[model samples]
Target: MTDIKDLPKKSGPSGGWGSMKGIKRIHAESHADPAAFDTLRRQNKPGGFMCSSCAFPKPANYKPFEFCENGAKATLWEQTRDRCTPEFWEHHTVESLKDWTDHELESTGRLTAPMRYDAATDRYVEVTWDEAFQGIAATLNRLPADDVVFYSSGHAGLEASYLYALLARLHGTNNLPQSSNMCHETTSVGLKKVIGSPVGTVIWDDIDATDCYFFFGQNPGTNSPRFLHWLKELKDRGGKIVTFNPVREQGLISFVNPQSPVDMATGRETVISDQYHQVRAGGDVAAILGMCKAVIEVDDEAARTGGELVIDHDFIAEHTTGFDTFIDFARRTHWSDIEHHSGLAEADLRAAAAVYMEHDRVIGVYGMGLTQHAHGALNIAMLVNFLCLRGNIGKTGAGVCPIRGHSNVQGQRTVGIAEKAGLVPMDKLRELFGFEPPQEDGTHIVDAVEGLIDGRIKGFVSLGGNLARAVPDQKRMEAAWARQELTVMISTKLNRSHLFPGRDAYILPCLSRAEIDEQATGNQVITVEDSFSHIHGSTGKRTPASPKLKSELEIVARIGKASLPPNPKVRWDDWIGDYGLVRDLIEATYPDDFRDFNERMFEPGGFWRGVPARDRIWKTESGKAEITTPPQLTSLGYGEKDGRYRLITMRSNDQFNTTIYGYSDRFRGIEGTRDVLLMNQMDMAELNLIKGDKVAMVSDYDDGEDRRLGGLSVIPFDLPRGTVGSYYPECNVLIAISHHDELSKTPASKSVPVRIERDGLAQS
Candidate 1:
């Protein structure tokens, strides 16, 4: 008999009983353990570690219950009472455990000690920490420097990622890639080209100041629920919340403040979106062009009629350049093309523009929806253009917020975890750490995966990430590991990647962000930067789950010492023992940015790593804001939309990236299972598909390989016609690695062309 998932018939407001159930699920998952409760309390308290969930920065003033629903799940996932001991591995071989789901693997529990692969036994047996480190070093030292790829995860805090990148550079390769490559690389690359900084221009307070805003390609309700509170507050304060996406997310439609017991009990949900437009996948650039054209036309008409012009002429003329060129290009971009591609009417575009032009301050925000496409960078640049038209950037309630995926993903890049070799100057690195950092650009996730597949890269070192599952082409990437000489993971728990061991594999168990990390110096306090560039310190105060587990800092330092030739002059030991020295060195390298990094850590609310773009200090090559031409229709096309449908992969409310916390998406009304596809009702009707119709999606690309996902049932959704949605990692298999944004190299995970056919045997 087939597994019938508990599909909730009715979808309601995001944050009422549904959120309560999520909170309950978290508590129940932890088995109502007092330690989990205590751990959360301590983690949320002042002077405690920041939540390692999504990168929504914590408020400066601490709250006893600052964590969100997913935050609780994240902590519970890390601090679970379950333990994976050596004896546990003896019972389940890696070959046997290979079929287990990603959730099952992580749920196996935190590793109690280091483990090494046993070829004959096909199991990972316990090994000494020294052996793990030495073995990692030996493997890397033996391989060609470029053959080793170092990947970083968002869950990895700022300090750990920094040290991880440094160790990789010390090992003499720039083959460093991280979560940024998969999510916000477009934001960084695009913004840096114009604004001179690859970061969001707005701080948290800007949310309150803006009177009107649009979230293009973002649904904070599921990805960032805590952000929904802010969105609710914006609406409560008479601010307009406009949304543009292929699927009209329920969270954007309305929300009930989970923290407000009165609203939660009364079943009162506040309306969130003033305007919602269902733009198709890869249609964002066209939509943005339409908006700009509308604003320009309005200004032109107002000028001719002797009415007040709506454009922020002063801000545009003084703070930015190339506006006239942008206007010319936007005018040249035809309304019909935009309408055809975006599935939006000119009237709707003008109405949204009316809202934008009426407001003096507007904050524009976006996520992976904009960044994971062929013209992703252009999509981001065009967004900056929208804000620039109204003088929004660097204003009180006006700026760009590139909503990042991981808590410290932005923070890692801040402290020096870059794939580009010279990101941290070799002169500066040698002056501080006494080593010549390589000068060639390194492999990002896509390049790393390609290298691994082609046998060019034989060793892979990941700092707490499920790379095999997270990347596109799941089967190919997973099998590519077999060709590797060695694979090492410095992580707290076992994941899908661990099960796919290479010839030589090691699991170096490290402490999570929730546990107390006592170094030789004392209890170490690590710093993490938020999406908005606020740097804060997080000190995990709970007792370690296993005394055998070492801090991420310790693991990196040990590996560095063993891997690199002895250089007593470089205080790797001191930096490892005391993070303050590391911060001091960071300040030494980035004197202006981290002037008083150590002292700032003690600030009541974290200090800001100010963006020059927000301050009107242009850092671009032109010394002013630069604008790009509106994307050509070719860059925004999805072949012929006859029988093929545009697919957009998203995260379920119960999931975070590849980490599947649960099977249900409470927000989307899908429950108890992930083996379902969310297709537009019209599309489903056209295909004669019904709910629970077993089908397999076939990729439209002629990639020689038959890329397909079989036995997925179709479920109707409120999405644009010819567009469909499914949770990522599950759908990641359909996206070809070659299908990526040319500029940022980010996988076009959000938009993939596919066609679905009913599975006869499965239906039978």
Candidate 2:
């Protein structure tokens, strides 16, 4: 048997897809000059496209060439020389395309024309733009507005999202399911309940001013490398960072900023977190409760001795309610239980609490790692409770930051893409659009899939996103898509979702951010909101990949005009023809911060929407930040038997959410493949599993009968016991649709129970 220690070491450049096996894949293709690429990445330029990779906020001051490795790859991938015209589709059948790997299908390059599925040949055939739009309009007009679902991706611009929201509302449907429904929906739900806002309160500058940084379930190195700049500054000034995650991500340990030439030349990597703890999977809620318990215990001791150990007793006494209830729960929580569940000693937790008590200002940042659990919403609520106990919500350098994945995902929600029950925004939409939008409370991404399988939904119109691949249960999702009567996709490049064609399907080619868009008006500038809530103007610098392609705004506008009855009151076509006019309408429709969208976006460094929390103004019902009670300690519902493990899905360092940049995870020492699973040495030994052993993981849920995803190679590492990790999208099949947060409807992608056996072996 091969020992894990003898496994080959993965080698590659320090950052981005430089470590990917397909490093030369783009270089092999014929591309334009580097100067043109540099010109597109410039700040204050009209065409500075938001990085399609992650939702890292663009720096206030722009660099000459600020594109990251993954961002450059996404740009080149969208603006490649390769073309998939009618002839290419003629050669490949839908069945054949189905067999092709995701990387192979995408690498085939950009689609140059609109295409419709040809049932006769089982392949897509080229269609005219007018014919495609007319067919879509006909189907949309036939269906009840509630039956039609409009899904948006984070890759879209603010202008495009605004147009999409308007079109959906104008058409009388509030069924706008976005990428946020799958990722940060829990953050939005939990934060709103606690602080009256869904977005994070921290800014880039806040990181530097904070005395302590607490990161939960986030790996900044791979997920958001741009954060390293702020962490480095914090470390330089003697500030400390604390990290809590199930896996010891390399990014949390050390990061060598690729943007810093001197650091890169010197090969010096800055240590990020001063202390790191690997909490057990699905243990974030417990870990946070443990910390709060320690704080309360210290306060009790201080009160008995006539000394002050608690940080913000006055803030808690005056501002919060239900404190006695929260304290009762905290005092009842046992140290042994906390230690066992969190996989950390009580001493470590107390040490962390000490740092929080000593520091006057602290910031807590998190990502999907916390929100992908069954108790994800509860985890976020507990984090909020901890912060409010210290009056950290509305203070400089102290707040909660939920790092969003898509570039404009947070912005999409901010501009009214939610299905929140009885939300005031939906009522506002009715006042603006005349028609009372469906108030039945529409479906989220998971519910949408269930609706698709249950035959409640018939039509799907996606603005931008690989929806089929992005959601869990890929096989089931693909089958459901096949059942749809009409499925329309507006995409910039070919992806897995395009291949999941309906009986009547259309793939409309669209313009990318890097491409110059010449609309009916001479030229256009689009707006985008970053993770930090900064709205900025972006223009296209390069030529459009094809004359056949149209901007997302144009396609949605045309569809709205074609589907809706002629209403002279709302000039849909005019707005579609001119994007700035759409921005003006948005400014008027939602007049809180964007009074003059066009003028504010023109200024350098863009403009910030008002964040009342940043100024210590709590928008909660009581006009004070609320303290939440800790979650009840119940059995995690995992019947831990011999040889059972909890498998958590994760993104590779080189990859973004679902888009596979390349099949290598550099930090984990994985290469040339994403087919391996990370396991703890103790678990592997107890299960009698050796390194390189082929294993099959079956879901523990009875409803997940078809959820037996297998053929994974086992790789033992320093992960926590009873926990395993694998790449997402591939492992998404193992997660059952029913396994989701009840409040937010987000899939529990981080906490899936499974029993692994040797390949082709039956359960013991």
Candidate 3:
């Protein structure tokens, strides 16, 4: 049915005429009208809607075409004319729809009305908003508050997420498992331990002034294409960039800025990274360790020879602790272990260290590559140690920047969508809401899924996300999903999660960020925090896709009103009438971050949520930045052993997280399919397999349960030996739910030890 063999390999720079065509094609396919042009104009501008594509902060300087190809896709996806109304549902049965691909399911279009699953008819029947809300509340009130988990996606704005969290806490539980727990939770936990802040210290201005940017496991070309414009500027300004990833991403190599008419006209490209080191999968820790070792050893040499000091002794002594122990551990780590485990040479690492030594202002940028590991927090901790040796933190253009996915993920966390009660101001919430919030740490995604299977969690309420597909252990999750007593989804479109209805299920239609949210206070503005911690307001310009659609704020408010009993302090009606009241409450809860929220949020480009770490104010217990070493210099899961290859899960250029927009991954030269695996030619030769050979992958774990995928066509590519690459979510079945970061509880989606076998035999 699919042919990947004939797919032409994508070469040259990313973002050229290819991007222009991509933008045009998506909109054309979505049947966008002429007015869509005006809509695109307002994207990422002040008093306009924010791009929900990626969480990269909007640049202070705005351009006419600020949106990227993927942003156009996201916009058009929401503005689509296709509607999955009652007529569409009446024609298709749930069993029949279950066989549809994720792309096919979402492509069916937007859900126009509230729907309730009918077990007898095996279909979804349209229902009124009152019926849906009351039914959900009835079930939620009957169950123990702890038995229900409130799940949120990054789609919801800050006000909606704040209201969602408030509702859950008022309902007497804090089981708010969100999408952040699956992606960048390690960044929060790890960075907080060292710098006392859970997010990056660098702002847009810092990025503009940075001397060097070291990118690890993040591909800006695909996930956040808008970032490439800044990277282009950084390169043109003579800044250096070093990349550490198993696969050579096109985005990291070079870029053709479509905004530059001269470059686009001449077909010229600007190089993005100075050094591209193809580190083996899950080798980030070892690589960081090796870098530290080089910096330390070179500094010792400088001391002996009276050369220039590479390590900042003054900064270290004054602004940090545990440097002595960390340096000792770095010295003890042998080069052999570093080279073998890191899949990088000693000279390469030293060269990278030299680059680091040459620059005073450096930014360590990473993505899920560093996280999504068994020891993800430790991986991040090692990176921090590397940056700390040169006093990178608390500098103008230097810090650890975790490139987060989802537009408002960080914002959601800012408003208290977390499982850990301590992360939020519990006493403040109690005082504001007149209710004692749950004190116990509630379940995260993994624990929530287990709870669903074993009956600890009887109900699930999702703000907006495809939880069924986003999580690991898909097979197990599917079965567990069916066991839920009540399930409520507040979303704009149909998704795979809608198929796995619980005994009592409701799908409530909600408005998109692009659609106007009309409340009693007239048009409303919602806020989101970008990766750089810039909190800004977003105002929708489009009419609601359907008249029945409600804003996320309205849906959350309605649910809160329906579920919780009358409380003197909690006023859901006021929030529904005006979102400014919600901002007032948020300001009260997190005063330091949200002070003067209403006035400042709608300002030109929004205000920066203050980061104390930027001012050399370490929030750590030691009162200074902490330099720490990993428990061991092991691969943390990257080393080759027992003839098993490390499988790194990735997103195609055409895909974003779990949302598949199309079949063409233009940057990777993959077309019409996502079932192909990228393997090294040497590895294939050793196994006596040729290009295009069908293969099967079985996770090499002794857990007794067989985690396997079949019919993956192999494509030869340059990868570290004993390492392979595959698209994620589809291959999520290979990852065990239990295999996750011990501290962050983020699924180890990047590093799975697996054995590749010949197709038919393995399948049989």
Candidate 4:
């Protein structure tokens, strides 16, 4: 591989940070082989492997090389020739690997064996599959069902997630905390309260059909590249794209689709957003409230003129309740307060309101930036209010679009991976498996971590994911992992999670989605649901990295077999032998949308699950859309009295959730480093800090807990006053587990209160 700086910068959407630069470097370091491209293309064809990155929907009718840069990187990453064998483990101990960077750990390549950590040697030693399974089962069986927590990453396929949920339920524990709990739990919780559904109501085609697209706290370029194509098309058709974010993303400014030969040859880029407004961090609710207030203003004016303008009077009267209360609240909110809170000009808010008034249908799209804050759930509720004001829900080309991160995270939840006991498909599970599923409420991600720290959870089993790095408060998280009696990780590659060894740690390598999974029945194709609720097939095309590595299905099944006695109560082996059997169980368990899982997945674009609110048929207890009030804004002032700067955590374009691809965030002008913090020029000027000044950030929590992360290079940039942005996981040390969403329990990652000071200074 070539050096990160030596790589030629690819002209595309903005937000190519650390790993993005490394990916471009890799592309430039080597030429694409036609044979390799063709093989990858063939493998990526519909009905084959799902894109291992974002869950952006692909048109069922279209069959083009439509994959994005990140998708290509994900594909090439798994296709690499690297390997991590028993010899590699013999050379490096767990303590030694802990010193390695995240990129270095994963770049070592795939794990080639089932390994168990030997406490004495402090190194991973190869173990037989039976012995590993027996050990895992023994540990799990020793703990109370509630004491064993099961965590799943979104990377797992629908088959694997379903099997995982089944395993957890079969063990009589509802402790299934998934990746969605950390990311989109706000969307799920907020939408369920208002619209009676968790997933986005809009489809890919809805972008082209809508008159207005409202983007909130999402950077499409780096996060969901595939959505850019639709945004480009929407712009070409003169449809309005309005953006609300803290930073001005390059993708939102203009994007040149590399796939379009004509546009690429002409060096022409399509402008995306018609209107862009920068809402300060933790200001999404205020911004959304401003929008709703403007709508109300327009409605009142239209009423005075004896006209029907933006307000959907008929739909509101028939489909929604609490309009009077919502209007009253909106009328009471002062515009000055909205402007101050939103950091948006009153004219801009009114302009956006005019667009909302002119458009018949509007769609609101959001990502983690909107959902990972103190008022995340409220932000979601306010967006719903914006849509509800225009009667956009349950309609074509209009609704809430929560762009999920993991490909199968939403699907996993759909297949009974939730903590809420009432949400479980109990009747179906009982009828199909002849065993009553657990009806007790389970712990979410935050709850699970707390349980671990509190000594309530003894055993940990992860079907797929890097839990240690993904969770907040890295020091506490690592300590919690160490406290666990036993920890089992079923994954495709080596990650930071493996380094934090438990009393008994077992790492089971699994097959990637790109690899062929041939079972006793036949070759199987797993299914995945995208952000838009479209389910499709994902069948691996390449051979396993190593024959010893088992598929997630196989590992989960083996563990289940070892843990549970053979009985006709559940067809665990049958489902394991054939992925279709698992799908069959899913179909039986959730007959509403997945009646014919196998047959439907084989269809052109699979099937879109039912979204009740799409038809304005809200399943809320009130039988209508609920109008929620925004929480009172309590000022959480930044910086300490010692003249330290406030630190906000963020992701580089090149990185995914916690997996670091490489160092260099091109859009942010950062290169060869992840330990740098982006600071405002004015803030630095006031603090007498220079661009290359070294600093250490510490938490400003009242408690005297030392939450300091040292060795950061301050880079002066265009940012909000008294605000500083640093890469996550590194800055995660500054955020405590206690600093989370009050309602959703999502860590306030975007709004951490920290104080940055000169490297060795007790007080700068």
The prediction achieving the highest TM-score against the true structure is 3
Per-candidate Cα RMSD to the true structure, in Å, reads 3.7, 3.3, 3.2, 4.2
**Candidate 1 deviant stretches above 4 angstroms:** 1-9, 42-45, 633-638, 760-764
Between candidates 3 and 4, the one scoring higher on TM-score is 3
**Candidate 1 lDDT tens digits, 1-764:** 00112212267888777877886786677453457677677554457778888888777665666777787788877777788889998699998998898888878788899999999999999999888888888888898898998888887766677778778888788888888998899888889987898999888678767797798888788877778877877888888877888877777777888778799779888887778888888888788888899999989899999999888898888878888888998878888998988888988888888889888889998999899987788888888888888788887889988899898898888778888865666688877777778888988888888888888889888888888888888889989986789988887777888888999999988888877888788889888888878888888877787999998878888888888888865667888789988888777777777879998875655788788888888889988888777646434435765678778998888878888888778778788888888888877887778888888888876577668887787898878877788878888889888888878888888788888878432121
Cα lDDT of model 4 by residue, 1-764, tens digit: 11222322344444223334455564443232223344457543577678878888767765577566677666666665678888997788899888999888888877899999998988999999999999998888888999999889888888878888888888998998888877888888878888888778997557668888889878888788878878877878788888887666667777776666676667576777777776767777777777788888878988899877778888889887878887888789888888767767778888888788888878999987788776678888888888888788877788889999877888889888888888887887777777878898999889988887788888889988889888877888888898899999997678999998889899999888877788888777888888888898877767777989788888988899899877696677787788888887788778888977788885665578878888777889898988777655321323235554445677786677787766657667777899897888887887788889888887877667788888889887656665678887777778777767667777778778777778566544
- What is the C-alpha local distance difference test score of each model? 0.81, 0.76, 0.86, 0.78
C-alpha lDDT (0 to 100) for residue 520 of candidate 2: 76
TM, every model: 0.96, 0.94, 0.97, 0.94
Give lDDT for model 2.
0.76
Model 3, 294-338: lDDT tens per residue?
A: 999999999999999899999999999999988888888889988
Task: Give the local distance difference test score of model 1.
Answer: 0.81
Better candidate by lDDT, 2 or 4: 4
Which residues of candidate 3, in runs, are more than 4 Å off? 1-10, 635-640, 760-764
TM-score of 1: 0.96
What local lDDT does model 3 show for residue 487? 87
1-764 in candidate 2: lDDT tens per residue? 11222323343224433423233454344253354456435633333656666677776566665655555566666667777787897577888788876777776767789989888888888888889989888888888887878999887777778778778877777788898888899888878777777788987667657988899988776777667767877888988888888777766676666666777677666777777777888777778888899888888999899997674878777666667899888898888988877788888888788778888888889988888877688888888888877878777789899988877888877776766546536565656666666666666888889888888888899988889988877778888988888899888667888777877899998887767778778678887777777787777777777888888878888887777788665677677668888787677667886888888885555678877767766678877666777555421445556656778888886577666656657678787888888899878887788899998888776572667778889998777888899888888778888787767878888888887878577544
User: What is the lDDT, from 0 to 100, of the residue 20 in candidate 1?
Assistant: 71
